[model samples]
Target: MNKKGESKLTIVITVFAILIILVLSFLFYYYAVKSMSFSRSETASLSGYADNAGRKESAGLRTNVIIFKPSEVLPQQQKEGYCFSTSVADPFRQDAFRCQVENEIFDPCFTTEEQGIVFCQINPLAPEAFLIKLEKPLPKASLLEFTQDNWAWFVKLEDKTYCSPFTGTRPFFSQDQIAYYGCKSNNIEEQIVLIGDLMIDDIWTANKAVLIKEKDNWAIKFLEQIKIDSVWQ
Candidate 1:
């Protein structure tokens, strides 16, 4: 009721209010940091291994070691032969393998529009085969025309077209085969998209190529083989 009593009361209230604010702030910061650390650990764990379904295809599955990217955004800044961290949470649960194609040499920043996928085929009698899925898609006409134009260089042995329609758990087929999947619109026939091996040179190194949009035109650039320690099923 006195003046001194009133002043003391006001000071106590102010101090309590400041203490409450400080406690709330500390709690908020603690939780935020904890959530972030957990998220990063989960991401790293996922990146360490391939999908269970993918692992089923082959028995001796080993982790493919390459420079792993923190995430899949801005593939342009990434290096070839590197595996992106975004692999685990993907629909296919596959890692993105970066391989240097011819066009990439000219423009190192050129990257896939979507997440690229990589896998391997198991063959007991033969060497390991790899499959590379490109994020970019080409129309049926464009693919056919490109194949026809480069028939001499693309087709070897018996001039057999090395492409097939893929509609399975995997996003794209083998690197040696042209994977025809996806459609631009409802009419799948008209807008059928093409991916996978865009080109295979019979000459020189027999380099495998993928289609990349350069300026206004689509260019076929060859990719050199990046030998990984293990084959991802």
Candidate 2:
């Protein structure tokens, strides 16, 4: 082969190799940036989730709860961590045995930030109705307030009255401004905000990371030591 032709072929091959390297580098950087952006978005979302969980736990007012001190946040971003999580991956799956109870409206949720215990009143209307005592010092007695006539207790959002049969939730659980769904014939699901962040410029400020991503059930579980009973008395 001619020396000139061989030199030209070598140059072409080198150029091709360089182009391939550049393309690969660009793609790698693009994906890396995308991953970073996703991480930030998730952090913000989880932060908000955690915040809502705190509020719900406070507003619940179920029973036997100690005051919770919010985690210390420095004036500057000195601390970066997740707080106030029940930490239960999924608490409402079948086979979840929970001791059921009834009580005054209370916040019975536990987060990792506070402790490893989750406490709350379990609605008896569930297929396997039982109280969920996730926190320490289980309920000594039961709060069975169900009746044959009423399947579940819920506050009516429309008229905000008919407090004749208060069963599960508080009548004035939240103000009129907050929107929620409730049914007279069943346990009204407040759809309470159990987790969240301070949304600032579409970015979460204070973060609460709830990593739960199950589609079928909730985060409340039954007690392993407890079972269902037709009569709570």
Candidate 3:
């Protein structure tokens, strides 16, 4: 009722309001961060990988990428017999990829595009080199064998075409083969929207994430590190 009492009451109310604001701000930030983390997946939608169930195929399987720079190596990159990584979680399984190795993986990146993907293309003869889903265990090759001629998939690594319909999971299938999967909207027959082979569209990642390049620049790169984070049934 007194002046001093009134002043004290106002101060307390002001302090309570400030506290509420601080609390609300913290809550807002916490929720925002949590949502973002959940949204983040350790996957990038690649050309063949897709979010649709019917589109799921061996093309979506996770593969490691390896890149060799021509400036770094003369000629091209060579592949030896192959090495298998033994870190696979299911040690008991006879078919485990635990033993890190290299081989059998024909094209590390999909040569075809999925339903909704965009891509950046490299010269089939891109001086820079790259590999997909590689393990350190791959056999070592001599420098003399490093030319485009020595590439394992050189048979299909030409720039003549960018994408084709996917028939099956033939590791050796070329972009032309991936064409079957597209339609009037996609028919090279329809628009022949042939840009530079540098841009790959309708990209999908192993985790079903779809993505498009922010720019039209093409660069070849191998995966940095491969860690077995989780297993799928």
Candidate 4:
């Protein structure tokens, strides 16, 4: 080939290579952003699943409003009521009721049998709170002790299986005459696990639990249990 023609051919090849590199880089960036967006949306939806469940329970009951600081202990007066429902906003009307104490803001509160009034300040340490009603009311001390000891088991069961459990929140269960505890393990991933007869399905974004009394002690059974096929494996 002539020297001029050879030079032109080399220039064209170099430009083509650069164009391919640019296109590849753009594609990579696009997919990375898309993946991140999907992750965030999934997380939000999972969180909303738990919150919405609580709201649904709250709507059915005649609830009262109470307010207290998270830093302080749950007042003895409010201890009698079971927190069947919770919310980030004031479920009551704008002027319905307000917290009497200073720095006591309503982040999440509960509905109880007594006057339906209860309040709690938002605690960063324990962000998630659950409403658990037992089929039979056990002594307050025994219920607290039993739950405290078995909380680790619950955490392991929830996360180790298919569901991804939320962390940092202290486990608290309220005692009432109502049968069955409405406890759930929030799942981040979309998967299913089977524990014995129970099937933990992430389609609901949470796993429900069923407690059975065995003579002297109580046992917790997740409606959905361990993963049959784990991704870690």
Candidate 3, residues 96-145, lDDT tens digits: the string is 22221243422222211221111111333444443233323333222232
- Worst-scoring 10-residue span by lDDT in model 3: 111-120
Candidate numbers, best TM-score first, in rank order: 2, 1, 4, 3
Q: What order do candidates take by lDDT, descending?
A: 4, 1, 2, 3
What would the TM-score be for candidate 2 when compared with the true structure? 0.27
The residue pairs in collision within model 4 are 64-116, 66-118, 66-119, 67-119, 135-179, 199-224, 200-224
Model 3 misplacement above 4 A: 42-233
Give candidate 2 misplaced runs (Cα > 4 Å): 62-233
Whole-model lDDT per candidate: 0.35, 0.32, 0.30, 0.36
Global fold similarity of model 4 (TM-score):
0.25
TM-score attained by model 3: 0.22
Model 4 residue 130 distance off true place after TM-score fit, in angstroms: 41
**Given candidate 1, what's the lDDT at residue 203?**
25
Q: What tens digits encode model 1's per-residue C-alpha lDDT throughout 1-233?
A: 99999999999999999999999999999999999999999987786555654566454433232222233332233222323222211112222222323343110111233445333222212343333344443211111122122211011112211222232333332455553322223432222234433233322112333444555444444434321222111
Q: Judged by lDDT, which candidate is best? A: 4
**TM-scores for candidates 1 onward, in order:** 0.25, 0.27, 0.22, 0.25
lDDT of 1: 0.35
lDDT of 4 by residue, 56-125 (tens): 8766432111222333343443323232222312322221122223333333343334244444423322
| Per-candidate count of clashing residue pairs (backbone under 3 Å) | 1, 33, 58, 7
TM-score head-to-head 2 vs 3, winner: 2
